[model samples]
Target: MTEGPPSILSLAWLLSLVYVFVAAVFVVRRLTDKSGKELARRIKAATRGRDAATDAAGDLVKRHEMSGLRWLDVFLSRQAWSRRMDKMLAQADIEAPLGIFVLLSLVLATTGYVAASLYAQNPFVRLAVGIGLGLLPFKWIAMRKARRMQEFERQLPEALELVGRALRAGHTFTSGMGMVVSEFAEPIRGEFQTTMEEINFGMGVAVALDNLMDRVDCPDLNFFVVSVKIQNETGGNLAEIVGNIAWLIRERLKLKGRIRVLSAEGRMAAWVLCLLPFFVCGAVQVLNPGYLNLLFTAPLGHILIYLVMGLMTMGILVIRKMVRIEV
Candidate 1:
């Protein structure tokens, strides 16, 4: 007897297997690529001590590509949004190419769409799942960027104090920055190192500092950059200025810590409030599977669901805004 036509579930599984195979091949190719190794070597060499003037005078110009794939990179280069995405990736300190992230998002979206199709009969639910999955990559990048910025902020005061000490010990500003680069850990070290490299690569101190500020998302870093710019124009004891800024940052951080401690209960309550509905819904689904079937099946229930989701989203945003005190 011949086999019957494959079901949607079987088709989905077939597609998932194909996707996994393609992803594995891509990963293997990426791992074994010679160009990636060459780029790594170049980056390592660039970070080593070298004659800045000679390197700056070299005819070699570095190309900033958005993606590893040439065609995708070319396409992304023409799009303004791609540049913003690239900046976000840089801020997140992700070494992966933009193409990889875009591809991952597409794969996730496709997978989610297929998976949702197996269970969710509603087209809107399937589309929502796909869109939500597509957004995951960007959400991850945003979270990473936020975490990195927080770490950078935490490291800023110590780095500033170190630079101030270096200045007081008769070192030049660039040398002081180099000291911070060598002494500290990432992402502050990486940021300062990039600033130093830019300065060395024929960029002016003020321009380099401005670029640094643009790259980093920390507000405390702005104080350091502004102070440096002001000191550069009108001569003052730079060491003392840096020290004062460092002290101010430390005090602000201390106040922020205290505020966080005080607001801990509110934050916890916000989390509980946000999660309680989902927990109840999940528990009900487990205890009485078809009890809430109307919510998914009926038009009025769908409208109510959407309205409730919107309100919940607004509430979450408001709660986040309330808890987040800018120091």
Candidate 2:
């Protein structure tokens, strides 16, 4: 059964709801950024005769760390899931609460399920649609985190060079790390700041660096951490070591880029092959609804849809395998 376009009223209601949701988001962001604390801080500052600049300087240390426990942990019975979500959100630079993100996912999933249910008469299909839609927020965050990590990887060699230069200039290791924090941009800056904070709070250098590796999960960073740890124990020229590591990573990235360029044609062809069937089928359905309806009316048509989906999945996997080049 073909569904017609949504009614104007329904569209208008959706738009209004979206607007409300967006406004709520802004309100939440403002609260999260310590807006309420600002007044209290200002009054205290006035009493103590602290400067506005001092209050503003607090911005560097101020961040939205989830206070107390979340209800999600009660149902899940594990702090692990909450911690994982927090890590992913940090990696993606998302400045929202975990609960808020979960709520947003639920809303999107409900919307998608309703839309899918109109077209799909099957109960299983509706459930599947809801589940898939529910994962969209997580998928979006994961994609964002992946992109951020890639960007971090790109910035790393230069960041390493800066750190190495700082060390060569006779700075302490912590001071050199601080120089990276000041000189480079986030997420490198934020990451280093977090590490420095941990150190200032009495965490050992090795442990703090390990936490850094866990959060960033970059191979080049792994080298940095390991080299630093080994050097602290074994004693060596750390600046030259870091510089060499940075040079190696640059060469590796260059080779990876060359591989990507070489495989570009194959990747394009794969995309076309995967998408052409869907495009042709959609055009045919629009032009000749009756002709396309015959397939839907027949039991064999359902089987064909499943078969096509399976084939497409296999083809996509094969193409991915072909194009993937590890550096």
TM-score for all models, in order of appearance: 0.82, 0.80
Tens digits of per-residue lDDT, candidate 1, 1-327, equal 966555878877768785886587477547644566656656666677465434633522345656656777789888998889989999999987677777778887888897788677788899999999989999999999999999999999999999999999999999999999999999999989999999997899999999999999888889999999999999999999999999999999999999999889889988998899999999999999999989978999999999999999999899888889987
Please estimate how well model 1 matches the true structure, expressed as its whole-model Cα lDDT: 0.86
- In model 1, the Cα lDDT at residue 74 comes to 83
Best by lDDT: 1
Q: How many clashes does the backbone of model 1 have?
A: 0
Candidate 2: residue 240 lDDT (0-100): 97
List runs of model 1 lying over 4 Å from the truth. 1-18, 21-63
Clashes of each: 0, 0
Estimate the TM-score for candidate 1: 0.82
* Candidate 2: 10-residue stretch with minimal lDDT: 67-76
Every model: Cα RMSD to truth: 4.9, 5.5
